[model samples]
Target: MELHEYVRLDGVGLAELIRTRQVTPPEVESVAREALKIADERLNGLTRPSFPNALDAAGDGPFAGVPFLLKDVPIAAGVPFTLGSRAIPDIAAAHDTELMTRFRRAGLVALGITTMCELGLSFATESARYGPTRNPYDPARGVGGSSGGAAALVAAGAVPLAHANDGAGSIRVPASCCGLVGLKPGRGRIPCGPDTGEAAFGLLYEFAVTRSVRDAAHLLDAVHGPAAGDKYLVAPPLRPYAEELDAPHPRLRIALTTDAWSGVPVDPEVAAATARTGRLLERLGHTVEVATPALDWEDVLAGIRGEVVAGVAPLLSAPRQPPPEALEAVSRAAMSEVRAFTALDLLRTFDAHNRVSRAVGTFFADYDLLVTPTLGQLPAPHGTLDYDNPRYSVDSWLRRLFAYGPFTAVFNISGQPAVSLPLGRSASGLPIGVQVVAGSGREDQLIRIAAALEPDFATAADRQGTLDQ
Candidate 1:
């Protein structure tokens, strides 16, 4: 298999080639290793090329023989789990997380882990520990994080699909910037267990970024199930999610909003791209209206803040915690600020979360889906969201992060399924994503809509060619 040939195929396409014996797993894997090395040099995404120690699929499955990469945030047995921070020493996981188990079961070849923001504290991938992950589309710009590394490599055609998780838009924002399909499956649709019950009190979701809607659907089909001790679980889909691609859905009532919840003015190009997606939805027989869910943006940020503080406080307070100098300025500030939080502060945070979730649920009772700009602006230049800057306190930093990605965290709070599709491009050729959100446990609907809308954009190979030029 040639590099061009390997980059052109999506995960399902590669699986077909393997299943039909057009190429052996070794042939495809060798090509994938070559692609990984080239992509790492060009994009600075993979934290370490674990090519020599890469794991092969155990049995034939949908993604059998397809090369894959894991984001460094999750635990994969024997792989380094850095969580993209210098505060914690990089150490290998003793065992696999449930999601990693499923990935293996689905026959995805584990290539290596990729880069992220330190503690995933910011929306940009510039961490003090491993430097920055550059966008393949334009190296001068940012690849949104903390899944930026995964998005960058996948965008540049290094791999068909890679592990990505979302906590306040980690997955979707990178997918938006990198021109990939980023699906943050509804809370509980995927498990995060064998270590923790729920990540960030269900504000976080585990999934992947893919080149096509079907790949996302197929990946979801392979991994969407509860582990034995999960804290949350939703009802299973009526049929396999892949089947939803061809299933005709009734005309959907969609709410489209370019307005940012954070009061940040959306970039004109991004807003126009969102509007164009709404028009495309209307043409596809869905009712598109300019409406938004009633949300208290402050309340959403507060809940996020509480979650961050609560999760990090224990780690920072531990006797063996890293030295104060090991962390970024923002992280050190968060460590200091969280010490002041009392039980009442946490109570208020939960109250805010309850209010925001209920309000969005009520809005969804009327509308089947909501469409918005996945980000408030185009990918920022490096250092735009610098974590090392001492000016930021925890609250101020969260505010800045949400302001750039004003539209995504609301769904994280609501625990709903949302997807960012690379539906439009700027005059300078940067990718702009249009986000489509569905009610809780309605990933099937999201899949159908994404498949319908996917044809409007250039193919991944075409975008990569443009980047190459």
Candidate 2:
């Protein structure tokens, strides 16, 4: 098959092609690697030393021979795990985590890694250690963080889908920027691990950014169940996630809001795109209403700050540690701020989380979904969230980061399922994503709605070839 032909197929589509012997795994791998090479040359969206023998390394299962990439976090083992940091360079992971084992069981070919922000500390993927992951839409703009490279590589048509995890909107931000389907499954919806469970205070989710909702749902079916003794696990869905996409949900009651949670006015363009989507939802027979439930934005931001800083502290201070300057300036400053935190501080953060979660739960009782801009604005310029810029102190940088992605952290805080759909674009043609959030553990609702709504605005992968120019 031609490169464009292979690249356009979603993960499930490719697997079907391979299963029927219409195309071999080796043939698919060749086309994908060439696409990744082009993405690297044009978008700077992937890491170097690509793993050429990934198809051979991958285990067999339902989606066997499908190519995928792991973000440069501690998601899997036995590969070069950088954690996107300068402090821990060139260290191979020792063991496969539950997510990794699940990936193998589900038949995903792990074809190397992608770039991300150091320690996933910022929304932008401009890592001081590895450089910026540029948006495929326009190389001058950022793809948005920790998951930036995954979003960019997929958007550039390198892969139909790639692994992505969200903490404070990491998946959705980049998905919005790159015009992909980015879903942050509710806390406990996917496995966290044997070494540790309920990571990032139960606010993080492991999933993927994909070119189509069906791809996202199919991968969810393959990897969404719990592992034995997992500290956190939700009940398995009654049916497969891909099946949920076809299940009817035309009567969803969606609440729309331009509120960014942080109360900063959303950019007019982003707000407008969200409104357009609201109208689309209403036209589809779902009732859409403009509303914002009463909640403390202060508590939300505090929940984000406390979890991330505490999580980042140990990773930097571990195993003899690196010199302070070896770390990014903002990371250093964040460490300083968190050093004063007491055990009570951690408890209080969780308490606030519980309170806010219940508050959102009550609101959801009246609505099936909450609609908002996945981001408060369109994609940022290259280095906009770069932590090394001497101009931004830790405080200023935090302010700017939330301003860019105020909509996503609230769902993370509430432990609710959310997906960002590439359903709108700015007048200048950059993609914008609209967020659809459901109450905790309600990914079924998210999948059903996303599959129903994505057809109108989701870009076809074949058009992504233009990104190379």
Candidate 3:
């Protein structure tokens, strides 16, 4: 098959072709290199290419011949790690992260590192250090970060799937902006070990942003489990996540909310898209009710942001801190904010964490899932949310960041499994995803609902163009 044709297949499709000897992994890697050469000129999605090892591993499991990209923020063995900031210049990992080892075991070949915001401190993808990763649907707009580059490459058909991690809205925000399936598994669903026990209030989770729900499922299947000693473990699925895709989700009571949790005005286009998603789900034999859960949205956000600052504080205090010039203004400011917190303040934040977790847990007891727009608005122009702005106060900067993406962080705080499905689009043509969130340890329900909704929702072709183009 032609390189462009080969690049168009989903990860699973490519894996089957390779297993059947219809396509070689080296060929896929070669095609991916060419696609990146063409796509990166406009998208600026890749930070570094990993062609050598990817080619070496071709013809190796189910995904032996399939090519993949890892977001620059996470450590993938031998791949350059530059959290999209000059402060942290490119440094290749000496060994694979636990997640990387799982990917290798599953036959995935890592081909490159995708871009992210500086230290992943913001939701927009314009890295002062690495330029911006533009949405493939419109070169002028943003591809939400810190997983922006991964989302961009997948959306542009540079690759079928790419690694993405979420602390706030990193994975789902970009998936919403770029038109893909992004699942942020519940805490402990996919272990981030050998380096750290957990991330920021345990709000960070690792997963991928992909072109199909099944690809996301397959990825979770391979990576889900405790690694030796973990801080905690999410309840295991009764069966493999891949199997859940075909199971019928019982008729669910889904609570639909268009209210921006941050009190920011949600763009009318986004509101319409959320409404349309609710209507579509209703048609698919599910009940969707528009109601606000009884919870203090502001407090929930404040708790998550506080934990983020405190959780990442230790990294900024490294003995060999990056030169001031190398760091983004927002990152520096956030570090400064972290320094202001007293030990007692962090303890108080933990108290807030327990409160928020319980609130979300109780809300889910009555409703199987909660549906909301993945983002508050459509994709914005590059550089509109300034990560490097010295003039902006930390509160002001965070307000703007939360305005762009308010729905995703809540699940992260509650440690519940949530996914963004590319179910709708803005009038200007950017993708708008609807978030499906389930209670703690119930990824199966989220996967089942996502699978049922996938066929009913619009495809990437409907909003963008043919992947095979």
Candidate 4:
């Protein structure tokens, strides 16, 4: 297989070719590696030392031998899990996390671990540890983080779909910036671990970003299910997610809003594109109305901060603590501030989470979906969310991340499923994502709608012209 031919095909497409014996797995892997080298050189999307013997590591399943990459955050046996920070050593995981086992069983071959933001904290992928993961569409621009490196490689056609997880829009934001399909399955729709019950207090979701919606659907089908000793589990999808692509949905009541919950005004281009997607939905027979869920922004932000602190504080306070210079400014600041947090602060944060979830859930009772701009602005220039800058305090840094992606984290807070589709583009031809969110355990709705919307966006081949530059 040729690199061009390989880059043009999505995960499902490649699997079909291999299944039909038109190409062998080894041939596909070789071409994919060539493309990956180019992507890393051009975009700096990968972390050190590509996975050794990755083809040997593949399992026999639906996507057997299809090229894939894991984000550095996920645990894969003998693969470096850096958490995208120097603060954490590049220690290879002792064993596979449940999701990693699922990826292997699905037969997706991981070529390497991709870059991410420090502690998965920011909205951009410019880490002091690994530098920035540049947007393929515009190398000068940022790839939204901490799934930014995964998005970059997928967008560059190095891999069709790669592992991505979302905590506060990490998956969707990058998908928006890089022009790909990002599905953050509702909390509990996908399992987090045998290692930990719920990650980031249930704010994080395990999934992937892909060039096509069907790839997203098929990947979800292969990996989603409950594991033993899990803290939360939603009822399984009625059918495989792939089946939902051609499934018909009733005319949905979709609420459209470009309003940012954090009080930041959305960029004009992003707002117009979101409104246009709402109009498209209206034309497709859905009722599109100007509506937004009533939310207490203060509580929502605070609850999110509590979750971040809860997840990161332990690492900061570990027996072998990372030296001061090993950590980013925001992380170091968090270390300092976490000591002052009262037990009541965490309790109040949980209380706020309950209030916010209930409020958003009520709004969903009247609507089948919500649509919004995936980000408040375009793909930012590198350093826009600089982690090394010492000026940031923990509170202000959290505020900055939410301000950039105000529409996304609320769904994370609400534990609802949401997807970002590359449905529109800016005047300059950069992709603009329009997010579609469904109520809890409603990934079926997201799949159907996203599949319906997929045809309107440019394909991977069309977007891969960035490689020529």
lDDT of each: 0.88, 0.81, 0.80, 0.87
Question: For model 4, what is the C-alpha lDDT against the true structure?
Answer: 0.87
Tens-digit per-residue lDDT, 1-469, candidate 4: 8776888888999999999999998899888888888899989889975666783455469999899998887478777677888878877788888988888889998888899998888889988888988888888999998899999999998899999989889999999999999999998878899878888888888899999999989988998989998899889988888999998879999999998877898999999999989888998899999999999999888888887777677775678887877888988888778878888988998998998999999999999999999999999998887777789887888888877888888888889999999988888878899999998899999999998887788875568445533
RMSD of each: 1.4, 1.8, 1.8, 1.3
Per-residue lDDT over 1-469 for candidate 1, one digit per residue giving the tens place of the 0 to 100 score: 8887888889999999999999999899898888888888888898876558667566588899999999886468777777788878877788888998899999999988899888777789988888889898788899998899999989988899999988889999999999999999998999988778778777888999999999999999999988887899899999999998988869999999999877889999999999999989999898989898888888998889987875687676666886779889988898888888898998899998999999999999999999999999999999998889899988899888888999888888889999999999998989999999999889999999999888897685558432233
TM-score of each: 0.97, 0.96, 0.95, 0.98
Model 1 misplacement above 4 A = 317-319, 464-469
Question: Candidate 4: misplaced stretches above 4 Å?
Answer: 55-59, 464-469
> Which one wins by lDDT: 2 or 4?
4
Residue-wise C-alpha lDDT for candidate 3, range 1-469, written one tens digit per residue: 6765865678999898878878766677777778877778778888754455452342455567677888886466556687787887667777777887888778887777888888887888888878988888888899998899999988888888988999888899999998899999988888887787876758788889999888988878887998988998766788998999898767888899988766888888888888888887799788989865566776675776685585557667766777777677877777777778787877776777777788888888889888898998888898789788898656777777887887888777778888998888776777888888888888888888888888866664564633455
- Which stretches of model 3 miss by more than 4 angstroms? 55-60, 463-468
> Could you tell me how far off, in angstroms, the CA of residue 120 lies in candidate 2 after the best superposition?
0.2
* Candidate that would win on lDDT: 1
Q: What would the per-residue lDDT of candidate 2 be over residues 408-445, giving only the tens digit for each residue? A: 88778888899999888788888989999987678988
lDDT of 4 at 65: 89
